[model samples]
Target chain A: MIEVAGVTKRYGERAAVDGIGFSVSQGEILGFLGPNGAGKTTTMRILTGYVPPTSGTARVAGFDVQEHPIEAKRRIGYLPEHPPLYTDMLVRPFLRFVATIRGVPGKDINARVDRAIERCGLAPVAGRLIGNLSKGFQQRVGLAQAILHEPDVLILDEPTVGLDPSQIRDIRQLIKSFAGAHTVILSTHILAEVTMTCNRVLIINEGRIAADETLEQLAARGGKTRRIALRLARPGDGVEGAIRAIPGVLSVIREGGQDGAFVVETEGTRDAREAIAQAAVTHGWGLLEMRPITLSLEDIFICIIQGEEAA
Target chain B: MRNVLAIAWREVRTYFTSPLAYVVVGVFLMLSGWMFWASLVRFSSLCLQYGNNPYVFNQLNVNDMVVRPMFGSMAVIFLLLIPVVTMRLLAEERRTGTAELLFTCPITSGQVILGKYLGAAFLLAVMLGVTLSYPLLIMATSAKPDVGPTLVGYLGVLLLGLSFIAVGLLISAMTENQIVAAVGAFGALLMLWAIGWVADSATDTVAYRLNQVTFGLWDKLHLGLGGPTVGDLLNKLSVSEHLGDFRKGLLDTEHVVFYLSVVFFSLFMTQRIVESRRWRG
Candidate 1:
């Protein structure tokens, strides 16, 4: 339950967050994809009420961040890029302090702290000084603090930035599990995390949002195009002639090598696989493999940002 | 008010948890003890000579009085220790990134300031406590020595320290550097000390009329305390001046109000500075 309409943050001459707007419904996970210095953190800062937007407004769970900062901030849990930790205190004490300040009930404070500790896998280092903990543990402590009070919405920036692959997987799993119960808006430059964790993606580049939609929709959007790769055993001389006879095959270009493989380049909505397979079998060619080859999220992201810049 | 206490409590815990708290307390006590002993030795000579020591013999001698001479050293302690305490209050947090966590909490900016002030003030009071035995020890050796003045003198010094810490907290909020915060606070305190001097030197009657409003404290000690020496007014307006009155067993309601007012203004300013960083960041 978030509504951000025409929010722009300007610092002197540069517009850090150019007028950009998007909304996240309850139980929805939205991934913010952007390169470094792309205003992703700036936009998240505005949403959390940590800073005021230069123009327009953002509401968290129906409360305006500017007009009612405390109320809005209460309903939204935020983890800033750096984690904003008090390094002098221990991990458990720090989280308890956070819970106290967030106005969690004193009677339930211990239970909440234990729950957050378990959820973030911080039980082992509970009593260790925050400064003494490893970066990965510190990052977990940061996440633990954000979700300690169980806010209605969770806003995390670069949630998996410094973690190892296993830690990253663990955090992503935790984040994924949060979907459909907590509305989360996480920003990252990593494209794969978006495809895996967030159902919807919002691509921001050069201080503006260039693309926003579901993963499937993003892949399906833009010009109508498709590319496929096929592996087949050495075909007879009639292989090209038989493949050309398949309907909706724009160009059946014979691509490379003595292994006799073919990459059929097609246009528009059409599946030429059955015809290609039948043609190969009819000619006594071994049909080994056939798979749909589409653009990965990274390719899509690079293409989107590059396309906008080129335009 | 309660939230302010919670923050202050946390600040206090931080003092002990990090080396910051122990280091500040240690340095403060050592310097306070040094100043007290130095004042005691000078007091012995003053009592033995009974104002007969030649003034020109010692270039440092402003008077044979212990309080006045000690003021010069008190300035150094204020400049040295206060910056250390106030520097990390906000600057370290802003550097470490906890300022955002603090801001996002349910508490307001005002609570943060109050909490920081109280935490620093509590440590300072403990620092002041260690030096308490020195005066009590002073009383043990001499029956005629003024104990009332000694208690009030300590009271005045403590208030002066409170004022410095409060102002230092505000200056600490202005920048993220501990050294800059220390220097800014020292400069501010030094100016307040010099206001009466500048006011006193004005040749023009109009200038005198204008300086009165700015240097009212100068007038209060000279007129209100009704002392018998040239340094009497200077002593009252400068921290050391009122300190001497307390050492001499005098406590004025006006001096008490002056210390409290200074404390209130600095705390309010500290709150405002902390609040501005969010928009400016």
Candidate 2:
């Protein structure tokens, strides 16, 4: 539901967000991964209509951000990097105010705010001043405001920055719950967050889109080899030799375990479990556990960044 | 209009809830009260000198001797207090990053600037409103208190307050620092207030040209001039010049338009500044 075309934002001689373009389909959770100063926040700001891009355009729900700002903004729910909260305002009242400005019907404001508060788990501190709340609670308040109106598009910048582990999980779950309902584009420096919550990842570096693909595609393209961890119960010195002798097996290293635990690195994505299983049975090696090691987003991210640097 | 009211509502609530509001209102009332009491004491002692004598009645009317000067002094007080009331309008939002919320909302730049201006103007009106009891008491106790000029003077101060608020809002939008906003607004207003002084001292050759742009409440209408001259033109520029007519119970459309134009012009500049921020950001 969001389309960005050659969007660029410049401040004097510095280009905060250079010409970068991407689109998120309806109900898709697109994770924006980038290092600090990668112009992620600037891109979010331009999409939200908080800042005008120096070149090109961003459209939300088919409305160009600059030409039809009110219409475009009406369909967007933005949670800025710092939350953009009225610190002195009570949590509930602030949400109500946001609801009003977001074009919620006068009669439905309370119901909407309550729903947002509930979704963000901000009920207990709803009556308290925002400035008095802790950082994690404040981040919840920020999330609450972004989803307050249930906008069609939610653009969040570092939404889970200051939360505890549990709070972060809760936010991640909440974001995941928006699947098939709201198109979400969240930017963060955290690589693991994208792996856990995002269906697709867009890796940005130096104001450019270095990589963009589905999570699975990214992992497959991570490298040429597929690594698998195998744990055999029987003690056999020849087990490692047998596994490495199988075709497509590149290398075998003993990964410390009870015994006979070997990490078999293969040259391709083919499954070598059938070959290894037959050999294990023949040799009377008790086959215990075997699983393919998928590439984490961290590994994929580092690889992409390192490859970009090398290029 | 609802968007304007929503923004205004938040700003007004913030002003009333914050310590800054209480401190500004408290300090304003205390100072105005003191000025009121001093004016009353001066008028009363002067009354004693007259001793029920109708001869000196023409020399000392309550409106001129007490209310008029009190309002003139209140106008100056407003010059100082308006900045304090308006300094945080846009500066605090920018500093706290709430401008992102506002800019991203469905509201336009014009709405934000107007809402903030109106909120600060309303607070200034309340501040001026509280001090009205001084004139009300004079009307109740004094049989011959001139109500026309007193009410007109209040109107004049309101207009003056509106002008200050507009200017303050513009300066507030120019920076993210509240202190700098306050001081810059105050300094700009002080220069406008002091420009008339320059004209008065140099009323010889260059004064006529300088007088047109200077703002002061004490400037006369200069109606006797057959046509507009440099001096009359300068008199027209004085923001305070129009208030002088009001203190004398003269409601000139020209003065009304001048004050409104300043408010409109300042708010327009403020809107431009807010718009530029979005671009620069």
Candidate 3:
């Protein structure tokens, strides 16, 4: 439902969003992963028609954002980093206003607002002033407005920023629920958010797309190399060489400042733990601990970012 | 149009929900009421001074002495209060980042500017509407004033207030700081208000020299361009100069068009400034 090509945004000499391109199919939840100042928000703004791209074009549902902003924006619901809320307004009235401006049918405004309020868990504070709501509730209110019109595409920039763990979980669940019905592109620095809510991940660094892959593909990439931690009760020489001699074992590195502690790398396809434990016992190293290490999404993200930097 | 009304309604609701509308309205009414009472007192004293002479009493018209001065004071009051009303119209949207929500909607920038202008104009209308009671009260307690001049004077004030609002809206759209918008609008309006004085006192200034040259050219060419010189053009550009005909109960199309042009030009410029955001961002 979204196609972006060679989009670049510059402020004088500094390019906030360098030339980049990506597309999200209908009913796909694409997580925009990047560190701060990674041009994630700039790209979303260009797609939403809030800011024109300095060069190139972005389309939403086949409408070019710059050429047909009104039509393009009609199909987009954007939640900027600041939430774009009027603090003096009451929750219900604010949502109603958003619905009206967002072109929700007159007859369905109330129903749509009620649905959004309920969906975002804003029913309890429907009549209260938005200024009086807590940060989490305010963030939810922002989410409610973004989905109020039921737009075909939702561009959320850090939807879960500044929320507590529970609020983050609730928001993630809400985003996950949007899959297969609404095409979502939510940007966040939180790697776990992508793992928990998105089916596909697009890791960006320095205003460029570093890696774009499905969750399973990403997991397989991360899973190709296995790490195992080993601690010995008695210090011994040649422990690293002995571990490396085992089949499927890749390499071994001693943990600094720790006696008889080593980390072992092996091929992800085989079970090298039993072999390593047997080698430790025969070599009289007195193996005390042996555990396989699982690489998290964060580690993968860092690896991609670091790899991009290296290149 | 529905999009415009939606944005307009939001602006009005925001004004009323905060203390801004009430405080501005209350203070405006108090000051205008004081001006009305003071003018009434001066008119009464003048009537007493001329009570003995029928000729002098005939010349001391209530509309001239009372209503005209009252309208003049009301215009000045509007100049003071309109900045307060319109300062937050666009500035607050930028400050709070609601402009993102507004601009990203399926509406044009013209719709947003018109909606906000109409919203502030609605408040201006209400402020003028409540002061209608002043005319009714005058008719009750004293000799009836000329209704034509009084009603036309209200129209004049309304148009002038609208022009002020347009100017204020333009200033508001140019900045994110409300105080800066307010002060900038006040300064601009004051300059527009005081510009007429420059025309009136053009004795040895550049305007006088230009007026002399234009007059000599008109005389040499026998173009018969009577009654309009460079000074006249400067006076015509002054926002306050066009109110004289309305105050005198003469609905001159020229003055009406002048006020309308001011309204149109300011709003048009405001729309341009708003549209520039997408490009500059």
Sorted by DockQ (best first), the order is 3, 2, 1
- Give i-RMS (Å) per prediction: 1.3, 0.8, 0.8
Per-residue CA lDDT of candidate 3, range B1-281, in tens? 98899888988998899999999999999999999999898889988998998998989888988899888999999889999999999999999999999999898899999999989888888888999999899899767998988999998999999899999999999999999999999999999998878675553444445447886774466544444555666788898889988888889989889999999999999999988866887
Model 1: colliding residue pairs: B149-B247, B149-B249, B235-B241, B236-B241
Q: Write the per-residue lDDT of candidate 1 for residues B1-281, one digit (tens) a residue.
A: 76677788889998887788788778867786788677778767655665455573333332335543443455457657876777778887787778888887767888788888899988888877776676567556652345555567667778888888888888889887878877887787776666456434443444344347667665555444232333334444564344445444579877877778888988887887777788788
Which stretch of 10 consecutive residues in model 3 chain A shows the poorest summed lDDT?
A: A302-311
Question: Which of the two candidates, 1 or 3, achieves a greater DockQ against the reference?
Answer: 3
Candidate 1 residue-wise lDDT at A147: 94
Tens digits of per-residue lDDT, candidate 2, A204-304, equal: 98888989899888876745777888888884888778888999888889877557788888877677878988988899889898888877667778878
Best by TM-score: 3
lDDT of 3: 0.89
lDDT (Cα, tens digit) per residue for candidate 3, span A252-308: 899973577888998888989988878877888888898988877777788888883
CAPRI category for model 3: medium
Instruction: Show model 2 residue runs off by greater than 4 Å.
Output: A226-266, A269-294, A308-311, B200-235
TM-score of 3: 0.93
TM-score of chain A of 2: 0.81
Which ten residues in a row are the worst by lDDT in model 3 chain B?
A: B202-211
Recovered native contacts, candidate 1? 0.63
